[model samples]
Target: MAVYTYTVDNANLAVQDLSTGESLTDIFTYTITDSDGDTATTTLTITIDGVNDGAQQGAMKSKSWSQA
Candidate 1:
């Protein structure tokens, strides 16, 4: 089991926790909002190392990947 961390970006929203059947120890959930008033949700799945971060240790994982 691993840890999944991420932050929702938009305008203003609430934080939540969700389990998408991914094999992980800890999981973080956030809400996405739209200042312009958009009625849709943007799913940000935090992965191990996204954006090719040099020091991904302190980076957010917002991506989706098939469990192995």
Candidate 2:
């Protein structure tokens, strides 16, 4: 099975979130102006899938007895 997972690494993500609304707005505007900014700065998504695998079988035991 092939699943897709995204790994995100944004050092400034937490700091940006902690910043105020005005700060965010200014950051956004500056980001637009500076094309080299962290455009995709933060959270990533992972896709998890469920696959169907057939049932399994168990082992069996046998015994033999003799009488006289």
Alpha-carbon local distance difference test for all models = 0.41, 0.36
lDDT against true structure, model 2: 0.36
Give the poorly placed runs of model 2, Cα more than 4 Å off.
1-40, 59-68
**Per-model C-alpha RMSD:** 18.2, 18.7
Compared with the true structure, what per-residue lDDT tens digits does model 2 show for residues 4-56? 44443334554323422322221111212234664534333343332333344
Error of 1 at 68 (Å): 58
lDDT of candidate 2 at residue 60, scale 0 to 100: 42
**RMSD of candidate 2 to true structure, Å:** 18.7
Off by over 4 Å in 1: 1-24, 39-68
